[model samples]
Target: MSEAYTGGCACGAIRYEKAGAPIAALHCQCRQCQQRSGTGHASYVVLDRRDDLIVRGELQTWPVAGDSGNVKHNAFCPICGSSVFVTFEAMPEMIAIHVGSLDDPSCFHPGMVTYAARAQQWDRVGPGLKSFAEMPPG
Candidate 1:
């Protein structure tokens, strides 16, 4: 069996534990991602199933439609305002967690960067890994 992954919010108001490694972990530099992350890119941990996730907290969400026109739910801790997990209407079986929200964030290793065409030139993601002008057709 795969090791269970665990993490929590900065204030510990929101804690999460899950089994299975991420199916896809990517850094997105889309305009929406930049604004959300307050940087050039937003990191995400895409897990297999919401059932595999165990979270503790009274979270709040502000749902927004993504460029793909999917309902993207932005969930965060109600107390500390730390962005946590999210579920997109396009991908029902997955829960994407913010890497920064992890108690031990070092586990996050970005495999790719999407929307490089919109990425800020001043804020480079540096070398290595594949980059795409837009989310590459999977």
Candidate 2:
């Protein structure tokens, strides 16, 4: 990607810029992702370098245990309750940004679907992508 990826929260209380292409992009259908997104799945872009992400404005955060039993930090806009990103305790160098929060969401292209076992039958993922019943192997 030539330009930096930029995005913000619904109420504009939080904004960010990521300076590199995503390392991986996928749709997570895990129960927690579903609950947070209020949808069947949550789409995200994984940035290889956490330091490449620059944020402005205060954000509220919540800690939750992931399926792997690792702590994950969910960050959101306190004003709009918009979930922005997540950081994993097991992978501190990576940052996952919610695709929907992107200024140009169309720039995102999910290459895979994860947590397929928990996915609702009515909320199927797109065709022609790699899928895993649970988390993909590293």
Taking the tens digit of each residue's C-alpha lDDT, what string does model 1 give over 14-114?
88898886787788888988888888888888888787688888888899988788898988888888888788888888888888987777888888888
Model 1 scores a TM of 0.92
Pairs of colliding residues, candidate 1: none
* Regions of candidate 1 where Cα sits further than 4 Å from its true position: none
Query: For candidate 2, lDDT tens digit of each residue in 1-138?
Result: 645888999989899998777788999999999999998999998887777788999989999998789999999999999999999989999889999999999988899999999999889887889999999999
Best candidate, lDDT-wise?
2
lDDT (Cα) of model 2: 0.91
The residue pairs that clash in candidate 2, if any, are none
Clash count per candidate: 0, 0
* Per-model lDDT: 0.83, 0.91
The ten-residue window of minimal lDDT in model 1 covers 1-10
What TM-score do all the candidates reach, one by one? 0.92, 0.96
